[model samples]
Target: MPGSLHNWYSLSWLDMLAERQSVLSGRIELKRLARLRDMLHAHDGSVTVNLRFGKRDGAWVIVNLECEATLALLCQRCLEPMLHTVAARVELGLVESASMASRLPEDYEPVVLEGDRLMPARLIEDELIVSLPLMPKHAHTSECGSLVRRRDESTGEAWTLDCAPPTSH
Candidate 1:
């Protein structure tokens, strides 16, 4: 059987909160996620998101986004493929424009409504990208292979730098 409209991928943020609508949950293919393109090792997994709409502080329309996924990234320390799990929950006060987003309450981040509606997939992808580490690395440097030694001219001795190569996945 076909899934109901409840499975629809996008909707009007304002309308959803006003009516206290059902949560929107879906998968976004990794290949289709643009912002995270450079970080992914193989573009092989999908991000799953569940968007729940409601009123925050009983006054403002807020969208609670829950996103989860495992992204393949090249470890900065090891320069090898590594798996990183991204799980994030964010609450945003939906607004009409960029300026309005800046004026939202301290507790609520602002997400400007681009048109009348919002694309859950796009939002999910953006949030996941934000959650990734700036420079992804293994938990321990020991996991990194041999450290290259460079000869210091002043001392005429070889020195090993602590950091490894920064690799894209």
Candidate 2:
């Protein structure tokens, strides 16, 4: 199927999809993805996934995965629940062994297939994990519920949002 959309479970069907050059698009509930759920403040949404499968360099199998999701993450600064958006795209080269993975070019991320029954959700989750910010925070200090640094442009002084004022000598 040139342009078929289906819910996929395992990479066992990967060869058939590669042969047809299929583009699979679907939504998976965030709560259902175990690894991802553990990293979120609240897994109450879904991720939109699009995977394009085909042959690369005439012989190597490749899958281009794109995932978009809005995750509820705990803001490290304010310790509050904040919405974080992730739009991750990765080009993966499938290989059966570590030796084969070593031969792949730098451009292709090697996905060593342990078995024919690999879950696509795992791959999507991996991308999401890497795309997340190291320290999640609101874009503006006004939106954050924690003490923030404020600069005085005229005096060239800095102060905390909830700190006591300086005492004049």
Candidate 3:
């Protein structure tokens, strides 16, 4: 229901090409994709999608999708919040039937549509999550350099250096 566009394929052959080939762009609220929070940490901002769909190989469908989304992640060193952008480009095939899965090329990942409809939102979300960095670091590492305090092994007390003095004048 949330990620559905059932009527997109109902247009006449010529009209469908005219409308679907041009970029179909829209913003999907992040709240809708919150279900994947466990996989997509600190997610925020609207998920932007640009897509173009067309027929391929007579019956199969091809969808070229581009997506962008922002995520707030904790910096690994300082534990401060940092904004990270996720972008992904994917070309997917919608096979006519499940039986075609075996015949698909090694590089292609076929997505079977339930009922002649395609939901770009869900696909975009999946790609966004996959494209996210395994470890997000601060863009400005110098700002957080001072915050990297380490504890003395003996005393178990956190310590930070004020500054390293210049050796030569």
Candidate 4:
């Protein structure tokens, strides 16, 4: 209880935290989450993480995580940096083994403990990764710097700037 909740804890230790209804709430630097930072163009910001450990339906061991962050990512459409905001909420069912994962309810994502320890930081990072957009881009074409629309009257062909390279006219 005295230590930081982000630190690794034994799977068995979770029960005690759940019993006390422990909550871990803080801001985590993006650089600390290496995998997540690798996916972004700029990792200078921090994410707000709020985790609550408890039992659900009086039988299921669950941890609820809520995360919010603003990340700088390369726009797939224009090849420029764009701000992407992420707000993620995940309900994870804690299980000791992979076999137990299937037992979790549909509403809960199963998090199987590796060996005897659980890494809360890794869990938070994984959740944030999945919450990211598959293809990051500005909402409107006018917002992009390199987006261009070209029309060839002879062939009736129109070209729009995209992730693909432009072909010779």
Candidate 5:
């Protein structure tokens, strides 16, 4: 599935587990949902989540999700471009409802579906946003070097300064 249409299906718990654990790999494109955009920053990327559904704790259905992807973010410290890997594992309640406020635990955030079908794109987008880093930073350590500069003068003491443009005539 190359586009957003691939996510419009109601996958049964049993249907998800019938396939081999490793065979469920696919890319889901995220559409800009009004509700989601209001809750988090705008996002654009393919969601690569490994899925498995199984019975656990006697009677509940456990949906195990392992997701990995990279998202563009603005660094909080320097306000520069930064790309960070987003990895998360969560078990969600696969229930059908337009509003799941009552079904979810007091502390747990539920990803509810409007209808019987659970849209994979929306689910993944919500998960990614929830898993975002509080502060994003560039992966390369060298990128920080330019931000920190030093000068050593007469007294043999070192002084640190931020790399800023010099004042011109």
Candidate 6:
């Protein structure tokens, strides 16, 4: 059966870290991701997140998280709505102190464990936010609607402008 997460979810950080034997898999609605509102065209669809905890190197506990979703975002090239598919994988090391967090390996991102608790839903949301492209645009130049011939001031190179100039009253 498929598992789905609710709008709110909390878990014991210490226990999950110590036991290192839990797998959380669920889907969250786009509306729940308030931080992503500015970049999205509509709040309609669900994202799936799967997190598995495991012990790494006998000292630290790690979580492997996978997130998948299709977001309706305005294309930077077209200035119109387009579907952007996101599939990201992250490894997090649960750390108790800032010092320990700084010492984490390059492969893992440090997640501070505060008060022996954590909200898994919040972490998933954070991952999704970072996963988004800095400038979201369609792949093909032909698919873009707002692409127009323009000259670059810095390089003197010509390229298609992603959007048109705003009209002033």
Top of the candidates by lDDT: 4
Provide the overall lDDT of each model, using Cα atoms, as 2-decimal numbers.
Answer: 0.70, 0.78, 0.63, 0.81, 0.56, 0.73
Extract clashing residue pairs from model 1.
Answer: 41-169
TM-score of model number 2: 0.76
| lDDT (Cα, 0-100) at 99 in candidate 4 | 87
Runs of candidate 1 with Cα error greater than 4 angstroms are 1-13, 57-59, 146-169
Which is the winner by lDDT between candidate 2 and candidate 3?
Answer: 2
Tens digits of lDDT, candidate 4, 1-169:
4236468888667887787788888888999899999998999988888889998777667899898999899889878789988898888889888887897888999998888678777887888888778998899988886334322444456654356676776
Comparing 1 and 6 by lDDT, which wins? 6
User: Model 2 off-target regions past 4 Å?
Assistant: 1-12, 146-169
Cα-lDDT of candidate 2: 0.78
- TM values, all candidates: 0.71, 0.76, 0.62, 0.80, 0.55, 0.73
Candidates sorted on TM-score, descending? 4, 2, 6, 1, 3, 5
- Which pairs of residues collide in candidate 3? none
Superposition error at 99 for model 4 (Å): 1.3
Q: Which has the higher lDDT value, candidate number 4 or candidate number 5?
A: 4
- List the lowest-lDDT window of 10 residues for candidate 2: 1-10
RMSD of each: 8.5, 8.0, 9.7, 6.9, 7.2, 7.7
RMSD of 3: 9.7
Error of 1 at 34 (Å): 2.6
The TM-score of predicted model 4 comes to: 0.80
Least well predicted 10-residue stretch by lDDT in candidate 3: 5-14
- For residues 1-169, write the lDDT of model 5, one tens digit per residue: 3443245755553345433332245665444444434433336765576766554433333456778877666666655557667788876655455364465544333446556565655666777777777777666656643333323443355544445556575
Model 3 residue runs over 4 Å out of place are 1-23, 38-43, 96-99, 105-107, 114-117, 139-169
User: How well is each residue in 61-102 modelled by candidate 1, as lDDT tens digits?
Assistant: 777889889998888876766778988888877777787777
Model 5 alpha-carbon drift over 4 Å, by segment: 1-5, 11-23, 29-45, 56-60, 97-110, 137-142, 145-169
Clashes of each: 1, 0, 0, 0, 0, 0
